[model samples]
Target: MVTVKMLKPYYIKTDNEHVRIVLAYQYFSIIIQEKVYQFIPIEANEIRINRRTQKVENIDAKFAFQHGKDVVYLTMAKLITLPDFLQQLHSIAGTYYIQDENELNGNSSIQHAVLIDELERMNILRLIDKALDERDEKSFYELVKLL
Candidate 1:
């Protein structure tokens, strides 16, 4: 019998269309009989998720293990059968799915606008100071009008 002893994602990558969860050594482990096996990525190492549904779309990953001197490959079919694997994956990737890109863009735009306003105000103050230093009353009054 095989049982999962530990499962932790190495990192998560998100784009507009999908979220990819990467796994690495020491982060994922399993037990078979009395022996513990560590997952080593072979062809693929990521679990692809659909951003809209927040559901696992595919696991394009293969792992191998060293048993004695023989290399044993773990296939997708066997991995999916592990108890609570899907549930645990959902728990880790849940927060990333909840984030809305539009909301983030709105907040970023607001910050940019505030920064631009402050810069413009600073430039006006500098121009006013330059007019006063040159003893140009007309220029000083014109710069002050910007306030």
Candidate 2:
């Protein structure tokens, strides 16, 4: 189930060549980006966090092609509206050839998982309370602007 802090005004961006997923993690939010049909494993080090003040140091991210098959993109900056973004993603998916039509049609779902306890500036914030947090200031500044 979507949690209290995450059930607020937040944004996402996905595109033909990229996909951006942002969720609140404890005192900070984690933004994950993956290129279409890529295998970019999420590295623990890649997640940016602030330790002293315990805040997210960076939010702006670039999704590079992790794998060599399909393409995905960031959801918020490109789509502008969530509904519109989803619609576009659907249309784009329809354009691809289905190797296993049934498999492609398999049911899936999306849920926002909270990594932190509360929301900051309407977005999930306050990660300092959690264990082993990292902060990247430049990234946080970028995320603040996007959120």
Candidate 3:
């Protein structure tokens, strides 16, 4: 039976589509048969997650483990067998996922505010143009002040 001793990403990188969990030496460890094995990044150094679905996209990434002189390279497919390990990984990554969501929401709100401001400005410009067309000096002055 395999058991996870420790699992932590060195850092998380986020883009528009994906979140990457970068791993470093000694950052992840597991135990099998009472012997602790530290994970070493080999073919795979990072796990990619889909930002929208929050699901791991790279399960085939490889990692090496060492216990004394014996080293075994395994994939996420193997590590994911341990329910505890999977749960912990999700818990850690979920924090970053939530942060990404908050950031996107904040950005959307800012964009919405900008859009609203632009729309209001356009309306004012339209009113100013109407005032000029009608030769309404008082309305034109008031609209210009708004600008």
Candidate 4:
């Protein structure tokens, strides 16, 4: 499992008691257990939210990967996009690899997990909101440019 701290934030907002941040492409990696795995993130085509729980539904991304002695046919389920938090979890559903004569056939599976804090996400949004609310064009545009 890859912890959230393993990700470097592109932007961070902090108060005396709170922290929020945004993460971007530069924050992702496909390596697992010291071995490099190849992965490509296609796109996030859908975004959903649950109003009652204030929880955002999973964002779908097309991903593909090939690893030594194993190959994983990637799908949206294997990629997790956290839109609100500006984060993404690659191989969240786990990946499988099987070694066969064809090299593409395998029965082995791999799992990579990403974690993010809801409060930290909210803090990041609020920081943006504050910049807009104050009509701080400089700060607002700076933040927007990161997106």
* Best candidate (score: TM-score): 3
Question: What lDDT score belongs to each candidate, Candidate 1 first?
Answer: 0.79, 0.32, 0.84, 0.42
List CA RMSD, all candidates.
9.2, 26.1, 10.8, 23.6
Those runs of model 3 whose alpha carbons end farther than 4 Å from true positions after fitting are 98-147
Instruction: After the best TM-score superposition of candidate 4, give how far the Cα of residue 79 lies from its true spot, in angstroms.
Output: 4.8
Which 10 successive residues of model 1 have the least lDDT summed? 59-68
Residue 99 error, candidate 4, Å: 48
Q: Which stretches of candidate 4 lie over 4 Å from their true place?
A: 1-5, 8-23, 37-41, 45-56, 64-76, 79-147
| lDDT digits (tens) for residues 26-142 of candidate 3 | 898888789999877667888888766777788888888889888878777887777997798788777656455688899999999999999999999999999999999999999
Q: Please give, for residues 1-147, the per-residue lDDT of candidate 1 as tens digits.
A: 877777799998998888888988888877777788887776667788887787667643567765466566776566777767767877888877855789889999999999999999999999988988999999999888898
Question: At residue 112, what lDDT does model 1 achieve?
Answer: 100
The true-versus-predicted C-alpha distance at residue 75 of model 3, in Å, is: 1.2
Residue-level lDDT of model 2, residues 9-86, one tens digit each, is: 123443433333333323222222422233232422122232223222334543222224543443223322345433
Ranking by lDDT: 3, 1, 4, 2
- The superposed Cα distance between candidate 1 and the true structure at residue 34, in angstroms, equals 2.3
What residue runs in model 2 are displaced by over 4 Å at the alpha carbon? 1-45, 65-68, 75-147
Better of 1 and 2 by TM-score: 1
Candidate 1 yields a Cα-based lDDT of 0.79
